[model samples]
Target: ILHPISVLEEEDDEAVIEKYSGSCLAGVSPKLPPLPPKILVEKVAPAPVLLSMEDEEVVRAVVSGSIPSYSLE
Candidate 1:
């Protein structure tokens, strides 16, 4: 389910940019899935280690009290 670019601002836009490379959606800025960073940590365990520290940090918020609420359908 592709979303309009406006949805990108609802979440971290960098995920699309970070995950885009080496993915099938190369050259495209796809919408970031509106999952919170906790879910990201769940998936990140088995994810590729090639991601940079910044990218890894993007998967988790810098502070626990700061986890942004993800907009769910």
Candidate 2:
């Protein structure tokens, strides 16, 4: 046995949008103006420093002490 085949019709698609979604749409934006003065004068400070210290070098000094040297005094 045999069966029949189907086919589709074709034409110019220049007006597909107008037929489905109506006419075209568009938008626009405004321009920007100049800004006013914000500052009058400027002053900047200096940076700081940090140090790690040892107590014997800055506060006191050790010459020699092992076996009762202070008893001689």
Candidate 3:
């Protein structure tokens, strides 16, 4: 005995469902105005030079007082 073979009737029978189970996303930063050249310059005071106990106390006192101003001001 022989049984009839079943066939798919759709025209695009070869089209298979591709399941992508993952996130598709991207990050976008706001369009910011052009920054000044010096904006990126971090004004870090130079590391204090190693000094003797007396000198360290003096230097600490100096830094604790008013910050020095440039003559350009």
Tens-digit lDDT track for model 2 on 1-73? 2222223245335444334443323344566687987887677676755434663333233334433435435
Pick by TM-score: 1 or 3, better one: 3
Report the Cα lDDT for candidate 2. Answer: 0.44
Off by over 4 Å in 2: 1-12, 17-27, 38-40, 47-73
TM-score versus the correct structure, for each prediction? 0.21, 0.25, 0.23
lDDT of each: 0.56, 0.44, 0.52
What's the lDDT for residue 39 in model 1?
A: 44
How many residue pairs clash in all the candidates, one count each?
Answer: 0, 0, 0
Higher TM-score: candidate 2 or 3? 2
lDDT of 1 at 24: 53
Worst 10 residues of 3 by lDDT: 15-24
Worst 10 residues of 2 by lDDT: 1-10
lDDT tens per residue, model 1, 1-73: 3433443566676776665435455568978889765543344356656878885675566345355536211
